[model samples]
Target: MFGKTPAKEFRFLRHIAFPLRIFLLLLLISLLLMAALGQYLSASFEDYLTNHVRDMAMHQAKIIASNDSLVEAVKNRDSQRLSEIVGKMATGSDFDYVVIGDRNSIRLYHPNPQQIGRPMQWTKPGALEKGESYFITGKGSIGLAMRAKTPIFDEQGKVIGVVSLGYLVSKIDSWRLDFLLPLVGVFVLILVILLLLSWFFAAHIRRQMLGMEPQQIAQVVRQQEALFGSVFEGLIAVDPDGVITAINRNARKMLGLSSPGRQWLAKPIAEVVHPASFFTEHIEQERRDVLCTFNGLNVIANRGVIWSGDELLGAIISFRSKDEISALNAQLTQVKQYVDSLRALRHEHLNWMSTLSGLLQMKEYDQVLAMVKGESQAQQDLIDFLRGFFDDRQVAGLLFGKWQRARELGLILNITPGSQLRHLPEGLDSTEFAAVVGNLLDNAFEACLNYPESDKSIELWLSDEGNEVIIEVADSGCGVPEALREVIFDQGVSTKTDAPGEHGIGLYLIASYVERCGGIITIEDNEPSGSLFTVFIPKVKIIYGSSSNDSDC
Candidate 1:
């Protein structure tokens, strides 16, 4: 009662090391094949030897029957003559024995003298009656043998006798064994070589697989997919030839690829990522936080190489859209601006409180009232102007904070005459607009603070008189150098040299935001010794009663 199924019985094979398992399987197959081949060759050899011996016996029998001496002896009933002729032919030959019989099947000559007069045993009557020559295997006077029988004919063409030539089956088998021994040795040698090669091949294959089992490799692939899907950043991996090997869903989405990621596989990285130099150039080293453009979208990218020992396999690139980075930057900038405004207000309020306390202590109540009136009127006037001109609350708040910030830094900030904004440009929201304005104004403020002039004043202008919204910020500070003016908006290019990574991204973010909104920004020299930055953004057309807006700005 064999209870175990084949699968259960062979389940232990799963635990074997992959190379060993391969070797064992290959060895088993080779052994089986060689065994079957050996059996086939053995059987074929025996058949060939039997046929060869039979053919030789038949030819020898015919030749003996045709001999005039043997025929004359048999015709004259001379047994002595028959024995002499047959003995000479059989000696030192492959035949075991030769027998001559009369037409009546009486033995005329035999290997044994006593059996010469006896009738030959196992003789077929048809062979003699029909005067035919044939071959058969049968037990005879000596032993089991393969015999050829030929009928002898007289001068008158009448059957006078029969000739028989025989070879012992046992002797033929012994001959076969002797011939096959060397071949068997060769087969064994070949089998050994094959097994060795199979073992080596299996070991080589195991090394290529990094010694991981098939199941483990599959599990790792699944884990990689999960990790790629779960990550927020886009990821792409390339081989040493710069062909894309793996790309995740986020990468496709960020690159605005509509087709499945598989379609991009094996394609050149340059075909998918514009300006792929960040990945292709200096591929041996790791790069971090490198800003680059991918498919026309600004992205913060990092690249690292994959290595096996000292061999460079490929590289993996991880990146996210600069919009996400800009959003974070916008929030941080707002927070910093808010804190700066609070600090500036706190310091100014302290000064006001000290003045009021001094007036109270001196008992100058009239001066205190006048000072309070002046402060309230000035604050109310500025608030009224901002509320009436700027429709967006975020932009209004930003302008107010920058104004206070300028005053706190001992700089005059001016809102140019007859400047107003009824609507922001299309595709540009208040948050982004605030970031753009904030960065420009902060840059101007920094320039004025760093390179102070006698007239350290900054001018802000805004207009939405036509299809485009225009903004200009001019500062009496260190203007951009002629060498840097061309590349000032490029990432990592900045007039400020104090900090490396921090100071260069503001203008880049501004330029990127403006470009996305179909706007243009330009820089020129201010009248005296400052830079004037102007932006013109196309606005969206609004239908008075319709809900939808078109791109007819």
Candidate 2:
């Protein structure tokens, strides 16, 4: 676990570097190369100067040692003659000094006027060694100088004194500078060219990057808006600050927002959208998810953090209306209620039969007979009515459930019987079919119950017409207002004023289930009074056959 690994950074790093980075990298590399070249040129120039100085010393020493008169002149301490000799040699060669010194190791014949008898501790080695040249550097009374010395001998071959010559090294240093000047000049020129190249490439790279073109990005944004706007549910996006950044066309329509004159863009989210808890909840919990109804619109929102590298940029939230969620839940609850009621009724019926059996065992025959006759007559009438009204068990169950519910609500339900239709759809499930019947019954109950006791009335009629199943439920209650009829099936559109917590989803649930089951619904004013709602569903192809039982009585 502790072993070194390749950097995790590069794995996620795209080509994130900008043009400035390229320019700087190239400029730094060019500067380093120029510095290295300048160092190399300086070293070569120094070596040239050292070699030239050594060569010049050797050549001057040979020329002075070949003169025999120079040796005798050095032994006599003749300064005037040595001066003349050095002057003459200066004209023929580049040597600046020639001197002859006595055997006492003192200068005898010298170029300087004051040193004719000066001791020659600086050149005694060359004075004793014949034809040998010695090179030395020293600071004399005149200044700093480099000198060459050689011993001069008479015709008898005995060394008498020394011949000395000197040359300054300042000239050699000047020559070295002359050689390096062009190299330095070339290095500076190369740097300028590199700078220009870096700038040119940096500018070109900036143009090539897609981020440089804002118009293209704007076009993409427009396309995304167009695509999302056509969707059915309303969608909204917000930033970390709870500001509404974007809203699709559907969302704008649902919320009654207009973009033409209003400043919707970049507006504080709370101004356009209510229920700030959508964003705030996520921020505090690090889990930005909210599903709630706000200002009559259901919204499900999700918030997530936005990040670049190790930096936290902010947060983004995306949400849509929760209408579908509510619709599904309502439908399920209605079905569950129906099933529970059916089970309870079945259990109660069993208990009632057991009670009757105990009464019989106690020999209370007259009391039991009277109670049985009353129950039997009621049961027979209900069974007879349903047997003639609905042939499908799926539809029959819904009708029975609705009857039970209406009695509980203190409403009188009227039923009209019709011949059983033969064919039914194959794809229909029992739950969906039951919902179709249940919703109609619910609508009938709600509509009739809306009237005062003196005006309450309900009628349900069923029949088949040319490959279609038709049902009509009419109530002796004030009909739906004409203007609001078109919107009755919409979620949250309800006519009931007395029912608390009623979202007006009954008609919506009915319409939605019918559409899903390939059926349709319509509404109209009943003749003379009240409202009439009709349902038409395509006949299904059924292969099975069954016989109907007589009325329970």
Number of the predicted model whose lDDT against the real structure is largest: 1
- Clash tally for model 1: 0
Residues 500-527, model 2: lDDT tens digits: 3575776787776565545778899986
- TM-score, candidate 2, is 0.46
- Say which candidate scores most in TM-score: 1
Q: What TM value does model 1 have? A: 0.75
lDDT of 2 at 489: 87
Candidate 2, lDDT over the whole model: 0.67
Task: List runs of model 2 lying over 4 Å from the truth.
Answer: 1-312, 343-358, 366-394, 410-415, 419-430, 454-458, 463-465, 476-483, 499-501, 513-520, 526-529, 538-553
Total backbone collisions for each predicted model = 0, 7
TM-score of each: 0.75, 0.46
Please, what are the lDDT tens digits per residue for candidate 1 over residues 1-553? 3677887989999889988998998999999999999999999998888889988999989988989898899989998888788878877787889899899889998888999788887777687888888888988888999999989998888899998889998998789879889888998999999998998999898988999999999999999999988999999999888899999999998887866788999999988888888878878899899879998888999998999999999999999988678657755876787788878878988999999999999999999999999998987888899999999998888888888888888888899888887788877788878888888899998899998463878999999898888899999898999999889988678888888767677788788767665688999999888999999877853334443221222
